[model samples]
Target: MTAERIPFNSYLALPEGKEFSVKFKERFPFSVNAFGLNIQHNFSDKYYMAPDKAGVEILVLGHIYDPFSGRSGEDAVLEIVEMYSESKERFYDILAKCSGRFVVFVGGKKMLEILPDACASLPVNYFSPAVVNDSNEFAVSSHAYFIREAFSLPLCSNVRSLSSTRFYHLGIRHCPADMTEVEGVKVLTPNLSLTYRAGELRAQRIFPRSNRLERDVNEVINEVSRVLLSSVDCLAWFRKPIFCALSGGVDSRMTLAATVGQRDNFQFFTFAGEGNARRDLLCTKKLSQLLSLRFEEIQLSNVHPSEEFSVLYHGLQGETRAPNVKDTFARQQYFGVNDNFEVRSSISEVSRSFVRRKFHTAEMALTADAMVPIYKRVPFSRKWHELIRQEFATWMERSSFRDVEKYGYDWLDFYYWEIRVGTWQALVLQDADYYTNPTVLFNNRKLIELMLSAPEKYRKDDTLQVMIMSTLDGDVLKTPIVKNFGKKAWFREILESSYLKAYQALIAR
Candidate 1:
């Protein structure tokens, strides 16, 4: 595909007095400039605007699902507008019940509010210094590259040297949750709402409401299964073709199980590559054959990245460089199958204590020092270490980390949800907008809270996933999951079991 054929679903927003350049205007024709805000998007349906009873204009970009009313797309947007019009104080509460990848812009008479989804999956990067400057010329975008270009911002010095070598060793590919590669620009963290008033912009936490009650583990599991299934059903309600990603992992398996009744409306696909990906291709083929489901395998080896592909990939992905850019391009080409919704299971990790170390206890204090090692496995230079440390500290300060106990949350789990997935996985999905319209069935805020409320033992194991699959389709769990590749898997399983036994014995003491 040529660069011109690449879709630009992202948007850009600027203050009232400022205007997008002629070049940008030509790219993004759908726009609304009113009530102290100027916003533009490439797709008209993805951008919706309506006035509330009070005449305050509410603009929404991207899709949303309201499980309560079984509403999605434009209907969901209207519901949000009505809810905000009714009670601004309960706006966050209303948002907590909905799920999607979206960024909302509410331009009131005196203030403008920008609300990202619970995971900030759509990503909002803005020029921080401009937000409070005397000229009030703030700029925000779904793509960080746009923000950098519009403001002539310098790239963060540390990010310029980032390469796939560092990522392979350290698992550090993206900036922290509260930062971007552009100097003086920051990303809006998950569960936080941003508002501009009196020439000042402020972001505040909105979810994990204080003084919440925990439920029984079984109850939480059952409710989570219901929400997961309902979310998938809601997606099918759109009458659009749905493509569910199938892998040999518990998360993707559960995502497939949730589509039990909607099998006729969905197709399964997997990426064929080395290691775990090859296993994924094998397992998905078997499962799909057994269930008589439509399936396709896209070979990652077929990708040959060109210079033009690199420029387009970097433009959409910004500073987050994936080693699989060629494969991503291949997937984008495969999306020619149809204009469909891609179901991903990436968000399911939030409930599985994903960031918790083997020996770390729930009571252990979460600090920048602790997080740095988790992200960067190999030792690095002092400058890089300090950069990673400072970035974690800033993210911790901006998030609700200090109040985790008050909200009945584990600090490590909170870190995984707010920082790890919120930053890294969210950016991955944003970059994938060029490839496919992706949605996570497990991204509902209430559903995630339900997963977190379960006992850690259940979450750490595959119990939660198994239980949900059992409820949806018992056949899904019949195929063995491919955890590793080849004879190495046998020895790795033994080592993992021995390590778990040792840890359990220590805990018993």
Candidate 2:
């Protein structure tokens, strides 16, 4: 291997004759660094970055574990290294098999590649034609180390022709505009791979489909449960206490119950808002107490209407044209930020600017070695919202989701680039210290299958079904707080009110 570019708190080495280079955003924010044959793992308690011999890199940002056995047994970095070495040639195959919230970039001896998890947990982007290299240059992964130094421009639409990919308009945190030229930019799609080799670029799918050998509902449900259980169990790689976000909803209720029986070293966290049901919290508290496990309740105050624009702009990161006043306020309250008048004005202006400046095309926002900062802020205006809605609708129409299953894929589709990738991308890039929702790493598909597979008796009686699903029989639902509000009428009212408020706010904004 050549020593042309020294590793900066990193273990990046190029093969003989060929050289490698890197630029850090801030001196590699990690604790310990370990290296294996052609691979370097930068470990931090919160997250980790690993790069292998093939120049493929993976950045894990959230709680990832196997859902089945509920064990943190697998070594993700090592697995990635092994996978890349064995299947380096099959780009999409490598990406589809990896687990966790991450951005995977595979750069072979001559090709630059990018892929997101099948669930779109992390973000990745690309730009071509070396504004710095002049030779074919493309970047992948989450850092700007390669773009900031490699190119001399702020991360925004430097060129206009290439800004049509789906990643940028969706408010993805990893898609920056200052790194590469717009005419040469592309955001790699989730469950897909972009390969740039020998002056040619191609995109391909990697995830495989189920055999479609029809089976009974019971059988399907069992398999679903098994998959989810394994997925969660595998990801719980924590020596310290682990926390889960508990909601009074079906998805969360079952997850909490399963976790209780699966892992002993676990705690649950719930968020409480004014006028919201206490059932989930009550259940979480009771379960924790009963299990002799630790639990915490994170309470959020109500946010006012006046501060809606600011919160929405920031949370959505200049994308999302719809302005749901109550939703915005709710998010602000949940995030525990003061939404004053000045904050509103600043955010509104930024939102408006984003609407105005966003060229109706795809482009590279940054170079491979660019720094991740609050570059182009989103603007808030009715015109911006209208444009965004229309554009988003069109993008959805063009989306290619046939490759993935439609069970939990609804969330993946309706959310695709917007909520799933958008929300976390912004969080990871903005607040380095913040943690991600644990439920994300679990096997949600299995949960959905379980719900859909229930007998007609339980499935037909939605009320009874929800109650049963709220918490493990006595652990969560037995609490006084949960008992008081778990009534069918109250549950129905909560759903209706929340949905009504969301709809009204969306239209009003």
Candidate 3:
């Protein structure tokens, strides 16, 4: 972690996406050889390299909580080699078994290109963070946010850039994995790009398998409990106080319920006004009392909007801009006084979010637009649509989710977890010293795979989540859901749209 290796805001991506390309080397200090430019200044804390095998280099900017496997540093490297040697198909099986939060770097001669982990918890943003691989060098970082934050690069807000931004927000990286060769350099997608001199490319989460172990409600509860409990134990915060954002909703309630018998190290908290326990606070307080845990309500009525915006700006390093949501970041940072560890039930709602409650298309089919509400869409030219189609195809291939009809139409689960949760929430929380969800903390890939693999019927209507919460305290099943989009919510949305780009920002893809 020397001064020379301080990780900058973003990487320099040449021929920037499908729209425009600016020579950033003119503004920044770096060279662009066919291979790649070598920019030494970085912000990595630890570096893990496998000299004995592929000579892969893994630089950990954040923490890696691989407690269950009992592996760290070089040992983890050796395990990677063995996994690569064993089967390319099962690479993530071993990867998921080793739980941690990291923006990993594994590069060498054996592996032509240096690839970051598929699910990076740091160096992330709301939109897709990209990595560029050229003939001789490797470059990586969050693209748009990086450019804006780092060099103050003025970006295009035309239809193409707008569509690009929207797609990137939905987990499609700024640079497509198609790798349109421009002067021997390949601007690769950030999510598990399987191109290079590698033997073969195997997408991690292909189709959901028929692994329905939780055939009954009891089984579902136990499995959910196991995943959450294991996730809690997987954190590196030994003997530290655990903080959880307790909302009045089922998502956080289910998370709290998982820690039912193990409440010694737990603390339930809510955020609202000075004394008004409405919506999030009211529901959270009632449940906290029922659970017999101290309801520490953090009143944000006194906090200034300027203070919140400041925390958010630095917190995300200018990745996402939401003055409206900045309060959450500020409040979390405020309550979470120390760097113990925290839990956030982020994607717990994705399994049953506004996107997944019903099918978008009339045919009950999932399309590129149906993934999530892509804001601010503009008319696409022929070439632009072609590029978008290419991007969509690439997204389908990488996800291993070929058919939404066969597996499930709830693509929002993946969208929320990969793009929104990892990029926005986890990225900022990690910076604020709050480690997120158990499925991530523990890297509980088995449980994740199982949950994803379950039939749509079992997955829908918050079936698993309700079972877990009700099992713990059925009274909470009746807890009023904080209506974020109710009569009171529309004003906020209208205000946001008006203050923002209005139609351009409000255009849902």
lDDT of 2 by residue, 182-273 (tens): 22334444445566677555666443333223335455445544554455455454543455555554445545544545556555566665
- The candidates, ranked best first by lDDT, are 1, 3, 2
What are the runs in model 3 whose C-alpha is more than 4 Å off?
Answer: 1-50, 53-57, 66-82, 98-100, 107-120, 123-135, 142-156, 159-220, 236-240, 274-276, 301-329, 332-338, 358-444, 470-509
Candidate 3 structure quality by residue, lDDT tens digits, 1-509: 01121123233432222222233333334332222223321222234443445444433333454443656544555675566556754655565554444444444434533333334444322112232322232234443343343333333333235433543453322223222112212222224433333333233442233333434546656665665655555443444567776776667766676676567677767767633465677777776766678668776544554543454344333333333345544554465434345666655654454333432222223454433233112233344445544555566665555443355445556554444544444344433432132223323444555455555676666676776667665666666656543356556545533432332234323
lDDT of each: 0.71, 0.38, 0.45
TM-score attained by model 1:
0.89
Ranking, TM-score, top scorer first: 1, 3, 2
| Higher-TM-score candidate of 1 and 3 | 1
Candidate 2, position 240, lDDT: 37
lDDT for each residue of candidate 1 in 1-509, tens digit (9 for 90 to 100): 13343444578887666656676767676777755667777642464576566777877777788775677887777777777877875666667768777788886848888988878887888775654455666778887777777777787765565433454244446675477777778888777788878767777777777654666777876777777777877888777778887888888888888888888889888877776455788888999999999998867547576777777676667646656577677776666534568888888878886654332344545677556545534234455556767877877776656777677777777777777677788777765676667778877777787777787788876777788788888898889976635456557445544543453344211
